[model samples]
Target chain A: MDIRTLCLGILALGDATGYEIKKMVAEGSFSFFSEASYGSIYPALTKLTTEGLIECRQESQSNRPDKKIYSLTEAGRAALEDSLAKDPRPDKNRSEFLASLLFAEAVAPERINSLVQDRITSHKRQIDALKLMRAEEDSPVGQFVLDYGIQVQQAAYDFLIANKGRIVTKL
Target chain B: MDIRTLCLGILALGDATGYEIKKMVAEGSFSFFSEASYGSIYPALTKLTTEGLIECRQESQSNRPDKKIYSLTEAGRAALEDSLAKDPRPDKNRSEFLASLLFAEAVAPERINSLVQDRITSHKRQIDALKLMRAEEDSPVGQFVLDYGIQVQQAAYDFLIANKGRIVTKL
Candidate 1:
């Protein structure tokens, strides 16, 4: 989702700062199907507030910098609903690793092995994160999404392990 | 992968016209991870040819317009190998639908149902495509990648089918 739409959707639940929204995507339940860095989230907030789809208020602090809290306006909710009612964006699982492997014969065997090793390492890390999310999630939908990630990543890891021997033998 | 990189990689396989390159991405084996439109492909080819990483020849035809066939140069092969040796870009499965569902509490139940229905339909179609590809693939790695796509897509379809009732019940 575009960061603006995602911000509106997040605010539909409760108010939060831009940091909260970014964190929510990076490590929260929302990480399942969406992604946005602080770079994109901050700009989206500015745009959303300027467009009046979202409104922001400052929570004053005695010591630290004031926190900017944001929430979706009525128009924002409608906009988000309209988006949801329309067709969902197609899923894109663009993996450069897989693309590289598609021409493994052209690559040095050692380089291919290193690529496979790095992929396994990162995918394992992903599976670990999903397991943590699954442990904390109570909702069925959350569980389902996390489980889906786990299954896919695990299958990839398994496939790599099973095939690594043959793939490396050509080196 | 960037269009330039993908174009380079595609040419590394064999020589082809720009039209053939587009067809390869759309219906050929490369459809799984990378994507390139004619808009991007033509530009990439031009740039690659200018850099001497690839060469193109004009082939005359009796009834058809002359076609430009592209082939990777020796320098292009080295460049492609260099790219493959580096880290592959991370996978991105951006789905606005799942983001919307994360706040399913905010949408009309019927709208949610329709969204889920569309998701299932597309995923099933994706599975069909993968099955067709799987039938023709002989490489173990190719089979693994296709099976991974099929399994992940099937799991998603199954989850939507199994859970759609509760999500729609809120309408």
Candidate 2:
């Protein structure tokens, strides 16, 4: 989905500033399945406001500049529901690590070993982060997604540990 | 990695026509971890040719247009090796299915069930396809990657089957 549709969905959860929306995309629930940069988030918020799907209000702070907080309008809620009702496009997983592994024959055994080790470490970090999120999640839907993430990452970690020897030894 | 670098790596495996390279990206080993469109692949091939990293040779075919085949040059091989030696970016998984699940409360229970069911079917299909590829693969590295894909898809499929009730019942 485009960042605009996701922005509406985020606002549906609660009113948020553009920075807060970016944070959600980066580190919150959306981080598991979606991504948005500040560049895209700000523009999407602006367009949504212009379309009257969302309303933006200026909120003053004592030490910081005024922030633009966005709330979903009725139109925005309807739009989000419409988008969610449609068939979502299939998942796209682009892994540069896997792409690098495709050239295992070209690299040294040391390199291959290190790559596999690094990937295992990364997956461990993700699983740990998801576990923290799972503990904090109260919504049943939210907990389900977090558990799914953990399961998938754990599977990957197990597979790597099991198969690392096969690739490295062959090199 | 960019399409140009991946093009070099694909050519390093064997000489292929632009069409063949595109096919590999769409359906072959690269399909699991990378993606490139005709629009992007053609331009990447042209740029690589200009850079002298790869060479294009036109083959005349009867009753059809002459096809351009691509092969890695010495420089191209070196370039591929250099790219492989560098660290790759982390995996990026953009799953619309999971994103839709984030708003499970916004949709009907039947819709959520169908979405989960559809995702399970997709993952099953991917696992079957990967298994077919796995059987045909002779290289250890190729098999390793295929197994990785299968294991991951199976994990996702299993997760959905086990958790569908949790979300649907909550709605």
**Candidate 1: residue B85 lDDT (0-100):** 69
Model 2 lDDT, residue A70, Cα: 91
| Candidate 2: tens digits of C-alpha lDDT, residues B1-171 | 888888887787789988998898899877988888899998989999999999988999999989999888988888888888888888888988887877646534456787888888999999999999999998888899899999999999998988788887554
Candidate 2, position A74, lDDT: 86
Model 2 Cα shift for residue A76 (angstroms): 1.0
Per-residue lDDT over B1-171 for candidate 1, one digit per residue giving the tens place of the 0 to 100 score: 778778887776668899998997887667767677899888889999999999989999999989999998999888888888678877877777777666665545456566677888998998899999999988765676677667777767776677677555564
TM-score of each: 0.88, 0.95
In candidate 1, how many Å is residue B153 off? 2.2
TM-score of 2: 0.95
Model 2 stretches with alpha carbons more than 4 Å out: A107-110, B107-110
Q: Over all chains combined, what TM-score does candidate 1 have?
A: 0.88
lDDT of 1 by residue, A1-171 (tens): 677778888888789999999999887977756788889999999999999999999999999888999988988888888777767778767878877776665545457677788988998888898899899988765665576567767777776777677555563
